[model samples]
Target: MNPVTAYRFITANQFAVVGASTDRSKYGNRVLRWYQAHELPVIPVNHKEATVESVPAIASIEEIDDPANAAISIITPPKVTLGVLKKAKELGIQKIWLQPGAEDKAVLDYAREAGLDIIAGGPCILVQGPSLLTHRANL
Candidate 1:
């Protein structure tokens, strides 16, 4: 999809980072920061109790208080991506952004089979998020 289409899909609703972490060095951690910088409502989904960029990181999607109209960023390993996708589907989440290295052909096929609108193997959230040159120009 084009950047505008992807941006629209992503910003249409609240979002959650499926593997977000508190570790400053991690991509998940940085992504959460980027989300917050954009003033987006983002929940961090991490099994650990550590908070990412001051946002509470929960263990699973089911733990989110309100998941309605939410999209998920799957930043976990390929081996665990399918499980996350299944959980997202179970929670009625239609949109997903699978970060690079977080998805494989099997995961993509499974997501398609499950009828999900997914953006996979694309640029990271940092590139496509509100920090874009387009977004900056509009500021």
Candidate 2:
């Protein structure tokens, strides 16, 4: 994961939490809560739910009002990650954060081939967020 890229991503005007869940026990829900706790503007994407944490959730990336420059944090399985990437590519969304356990070798390869700027593997957002938030404040 590239620290610079991650910073750029988190600092975007808007962010999307793909695969966000209502189940607080799940990482998907946890990720969504982190953004909310920080008072960030985030869209929750969940095909199965109309709302997550009381926020309206879009079922897919295609529903985003502004996808060309949007940043997204994915918390889905590898297969779903790939599909999200494909849609994101078509929408011109370039900044993607593949949360831990959300990616596999194939997902990584496809992101690369599609020219996505992704932060995958270790250092989940919860780890870097506090510092990153402070960094943003300082900036």
Candidate 3:
């Protein structure tokens, strides 16, 4: 993993928390809450909902008007995550963080093959979020 890429990913201001939910106990909800708590510009991507944690949830990455400038943190099932990865690549989203349980060999391979900056393999956003907030603040 490129240190620069990870740094860029962790420090990006605009983001989309794909698979976000309203249920506070879910990791999806926690991730969204972390972004909101930090006062960042974050879009909640959830096809089944109108909104998530007060932010209007978008159905897909293609729906985002400026996806290229934003990084994404995904917390969905493996199959859904694969589709999101494909769309993220298609939309030129440079960075992605896959929350624990969202990864698989195929997804990791695609991210590498697509040349995306990714955070995976068990370092969850909910754990790293405070550090990311500090990194963002210093930027």
Give the top-scoring candidate (lDDT): 2
Q: lDDT of each model, Cα atoms only?
A: 0.78, 0.88, 0.84
Worst 10 residues of 1 by lDDT: 130-139
Q: How far out, in Å, is residue 99 in model 1?
A: 0.9
Per-residue lDDT tens digits for candidate 1, residues 1-139, read: 5565465456545788888977889888788887787777889998877576777678888886656577788889988989998888888777688888899988999987998778887788788665443543343
Candidate 1's C-alpha runs over 4 A off are 2-8, 131-139
Candidate 3: regions farther than 4 A off: none
- How close is every model to the real structure, measured as TM-score? 0.85, 0.94, 0.92
Greater TM-score among 1 and 2 belongs to: 2
Summarize candidate 3's per-residue lDDT along 8-84 as a digit string, tens digits.
Answer: 88777588989898899999999999888878889998889999988899988788777777889999998889999
Worst 10 residues of 2 by lDDT: 130-139
* Candidate 2 vs 3: which has more lDDT: 2
In angstroms, how far off is 40's CA in candidate 1? Answer: 0.8
Enumerate residue pairs that collide in model 1.
none
Candidate 3 collision pairs: none
Candidate 3 or 2, higher TM-score: 2
